[model samples]
Target chain A: MTVGLTHFLILGTILFSLGLYTVFAKRSAIAILMGIELMLNAVNVNLIAFNRYVAPESHIGQIFSVFVIVVAAAEVAVGLALVISIYRDRISTNVDDLDWLKW
Target chain B: MNFSLLSSEMLAAGLGTGLLILGLIAPKTENRRGFGYITAFGLLAVLVATFFQYGINQSTFHELWIVDDYSVFMKQVFIVAAILVVLSAVDFVETLPRFRGEFFALIVYALLGMMVMASANDLITIYVGLELMTITFFVLVAYQLGDGRSSEAGIKYLILGSVSSAVLLYGMSILYGLTGTTTIPEMLTKLTWSPILVVAIVMLIGGFGFKISLVPFHMWSPDIYEGAPTPITAFLAVASKAAGFAVMVRVFLLGLPLEGAVDWMLLISLLAGITMVIGNVVAIPQTNIKRMLAYSSVAQAGYMIAGLMSMDAPGVKGILFYSMIYVVANVGAFTVATLVRRALDTDTIADYAGLGQRQPLLASTLTICLLSLAGIPPLSGFVGKFYIFQAVMDKGILWPAFVGFVMSMISVYYYLNVALYMWRDDPKDDRPVPVPGPAKLVIVLSLVVTVVLGVYPGPLGELATMAAKSLF
Candidate 1:
């Protein structure tokens, strides 16, 4: 039961694909935020894995992972606030339905 | 890190934060918002100090940041932009009443990011700086959360922006894994483009693509620009865009080292051409002034890319020159838009129908800015275009140059429409453009600089040439 480089990359690709699917499939803005969170986590996992497997001598990977988390938290906090306000104004978080601007 | 005397940018950041504190304590000043003056004066001081300190430190902060002509030059642009933006923003923020201090403080924070990027010698530093800029904007974009369009634009940007950042980070990790370091100079020299390195490079470019609003990743810009507060839009249209150009030139030329690749040049040239064409052509139909500027910003960005595609010192110089000119034309344009809208109390093309008769100074300034933006001669915009075209000619990219030339022609049609509408009389206004003192001062200053830079661009051109020489 050992995690390898390929395994980490596979996990990352899966998360990325899931995030992409969430962006495309989900109509709710909050759901899309989750997808972004997942994608960021995916990158984090890969960074940590690479640090463990590929470059344990340096701690930069872990540092980057921390940055991703910190940034993600900030993003989600503001994002959720925005969604709440948008919902209050428009009565929904559906992305497709939110189009007041069109040609 | 001069502990005794910090670089003025750092000083400005401290002052900006202090203002934020004061603003929270006392939201209502008697006559005018004191924080606006504080922010503007602080930035002017920073601008002066930043130049003196620019080349003083070749390698400071343990060589993590490299400050040279390039960084100094870019900082000059950012500082100037901050001052002008603050000047115009004074009137706007006074009306908002809620977060004027925070707004100015966030701008300082964003400037801090640009400083980091300007001096960042490593990918890790660049990423850190880039995030600082983006995170601040995450709130700034959605600052008007009460407005649906603003919220939608902010959310869209966050979602898409986060994805691009992740993809870019993945690229960074892969580069680190393959090259064993995230230091850009090291990676540039050591990288041989293994499968992993190549993938990382692509991801890095994609992330930058999003930031610069290059084509596919550009979907968020128009929305975000229209959604953000007006001053923030000015920041995005000028300061943020300059930051992108700064990093792009550095990372592409100094960090990545994609040399001797004709195919790469061809790809970039094609992208530049199409972006120039599409951004302008598509903008013709937009009625929202903010959104129109957003599209125009995209097209302007394409011109910067054209500079990069040249891949020579002159090409680099072209990008620098274009970036400088762009800041002048765009900030001036947006400032006028904000001013006129505030006066007329409307934000539609129709509202501006009788602007020429109403406010001669404001309307005429708008006309000058629009003409410059359209690449008309004797305006800074034309000088910028000339440099880019000259660089392309040097590189002998006939098709791309032809396309850009024609695209500029197409742009004139719509850019002129602003003037046309202002003069044609839609029966919307006989009130005249209200040229406030501050607004009048800014417009006068920008108009002079735009024209001066256009006609006798030798000095500014020299500065950009020096930047090109250093970076390239």
Candidate 2:
């Protein structure tokens, strides 16, 4: 049996679910950022697989995935900066500690 | 491609870059207030440039960028928001420890992103523009380095906003896979009903829902609003939400159509109803003024979403009209709040006692703004609500409209509670609230627009109708 589009989509969905679970479960801000990166990577997988199989005539999906990769990198950079800033003040990156503005 | 078509965006980008260079070259002792004035005037130029392009309907970059009345109208809304924010933020920016130039420049960059969203004709363009705006806000939200709350708000926004963008991208990938295209107009013809399509639509809603701060996805807004600088909070409430609505309309109404695909209207209406009820109900008990406005803006988003039930020109028109007035009313309210925060250095509602006696201008402006938000008769907010509900009623959707009507009534209580504190209670301190010149101009300008638009919404109403027609 040959590998197919459905298989790739399943892998992508699994990665996405894992990432989302990480985001919800993780307490550390850095871990949450990692989870976001994983989710973005899952999207990249989906985009590439779709481009390879469905729209091979044009490279829009591949191009979109490239844009996603770049943006994900930028987002991570900003996230790390924020995490470092918060860590300097509170000495912790736990999201639960961010209750200064809560109702 | 006709470069002239992108004149406004180019101008905004140039202005942002110019400000950064100006900051570097200017003498260390020089005041940064000049940057604010330059940014405001530059945006005013961009706003005028959009007016010249208003009636044009064209697309470029292989139909990936569009120029039409719809985009022009939305661009004007964003530019007006940026201008008001910059004007009011001049004094606030001067108080920042450092990076004052970056504050104004980042706002312009965000405005540029919103303009791009207004004209984006492809999913990729939309995603890029959205990220540009969000990333800048991530920095802006955290700009107050000495304040832990500001930094906390920034990180939280970054994490949640990135996740939402990822979810939105996943949905876009599915859409491209199903349709084999990324262009919205191309996808329009290729779309067919499937279970996966429903998943994609839901993901899209969830993503945009977060951007507009719709209920359930709005968890980050109050924290962010309360922590960020007041002018930036106002900018988020007015310009960012409007940009989300603009793209949502383009994607759902124009691209997906949803005629034979799914009954997404039921889903949207359900969300809209809950958003109104929960937003207003939760807002009633908030002691902090910014947090209350954050929840109130969420409820306002629900009212705008109700207009989407009609899926027609009239509904779109109502949204545009309401967004315009929302910019005016919300900025007015936040400007007063900004002054109050600066004076008392506190955001608690009780701190505002007897503001009517101390500084009648600030108190009266805040009252009018809150009244407008509460939808009192003869105010622009009331007229805006009427248009939205009437559009939904015309569509024969009664429950969401009725829920909106009742929730807005519930909203009046909290809004008036703040008003009563200002007017009825004794002063905490006898010293007056200082009204800076630019902020005073913003207040009076917003007040006039709020009142005049309520009295005669004819011209703007017609313009909104025209913009709505162009979308179809």
Candidate 3:
């Protein structure tokens, strides 16, 4: 049996679902950032699988995955910076505690 | 690489870098107000350059970057927004404890991101441009590091905004997997009605929805608006939102097969209906003016989405016209808020009492701006809404348009309530509110544009029509 696109696609779907769950369910800000990273990696898997199995001739999929990696890196850097500063200010990194502005 | 076509972008990039370098060279004791002047003048030069390039359409770099009327018009809008924000933020920046030069530099960088976004013709460029804009915004939102409210707002925006971008990237990946291309026009060829495509489209909408603050995705905006500095809030409300709509229009109209899926229309219409209803309804109960404007901005985005439901050139034109009108009116309103926030050190609606008696010009300007936002006649918003509803009417889709019309009426009450508070009630302290010269110029400029375009909308209306037609 040979590995195929469907198998990779299914794997991507599961990873994406887990990421989505973590983002919505996590209370810690750091945990939320990890969830976002998880989601971006799922996208990378999808891109690589498509590039290998579907369009071997064009490198658009592979190229896009690299872009995603760079973006995710920048996002995490900023996210962690924000969380640390908020921690410094409030002594906690919990999402619930960040709610100073409410209706 | 046809360098001439990218002259405006290059100019912006150069200015941003120059400002950063200048900040390093300038003495630490120097008044940073000079940085603000440099940025404003640089933006004004870019605006004039963009205006001069009107009607010369071209595409370069394998058609991945476009230079058309639509992008040019959108570029002009972003430049105007940046100029207004920089001007209004001059005094406000002086009040901040640190990072004054970096603040102005980041603003110019963000403007460049918007310019690129407006011109992006491929998914990769769009993603990059959007991240460039959002990352700068995350910093801008959290610029007051010592302020807990600012840091919290920044974190909220960072988390939510990143999640939305991840979702959008997932959707884009799927679209790429299916189509083997990222260029929007080329992708249109491979698009078909498949379950995967359906999921992709849904994800795309969800991602863009968060950016435009359409109802469910709008949770962060009010908090961020209330927490971030008022100028940044105004920029987020006007330039950022406009950039989102511009990219949305490009992607949805050009990339997706709107004609293939009537379900997409239903989906967007539902979002629009709920967004307008909730945004306006929630705004009524808010006492904080910044948060109130946040909800009101959400509702305004809903009206623009309503225009998109028509899915025709006129509908797109309606969005274009309405977005321009919105930038002027909403920025005017926010500038007034900034001035009021500075004077009273409060944002409560009740505290605005006796404004009409004390600072008659600011109060009256804000009233006119709010009235314009409420879609009152002889104001630009009235004509803007009329165009959108007319386009929706042409589609024979009466319900969403009807919902929009009624919601506009509900919106009028709350908008006028602010006016009533200003004119009717007495102030606790009857001290005078000082209006600085630069901020006063911004207010008067926006006021003039609002009233002028409201009365004679032909030239701008024609330009919007052309821009909308170019996309199709």
Candidate no. 3 TM-score: 0.98
**Which residue ranges in model 2 land beyond 4 Å of their true spot?**
none
- The DockQ assigned to candidate 3 is 0.86
Question: How much is B259 displaced in model 1, in angstroms?
Answer: 4.8
Highest TM-score scorer? 2
Docking class of 2: high
How do the residues B40-119 of candidate 3 rate in per-residue lDDT, one tens digit apiece? 99999999899867777788898789988889989888888899999999888988888789899999989999999999
TM per candidate comes to: 0.94, 0.99, 0.98
Give the alpha carbon lDDT tens digit for every residue of B374-427 in model 2: 898898999989988998899787887779878888999999999999999999
Q: Which digits, one per residue and each the tens of the lDDT, describe model 1 over residues A17-93?
A: 89878978999998988988888888888888888887799897898788778878887887788788788888888
RMSD score of candidate 3 (Å): 1.2
Better of 1 and 2 by lDDT: 2
Off by over 4 Å in 1: B1-6, B27-32, B259-263
Reference-based lDDT, residue B363, model 2? 90
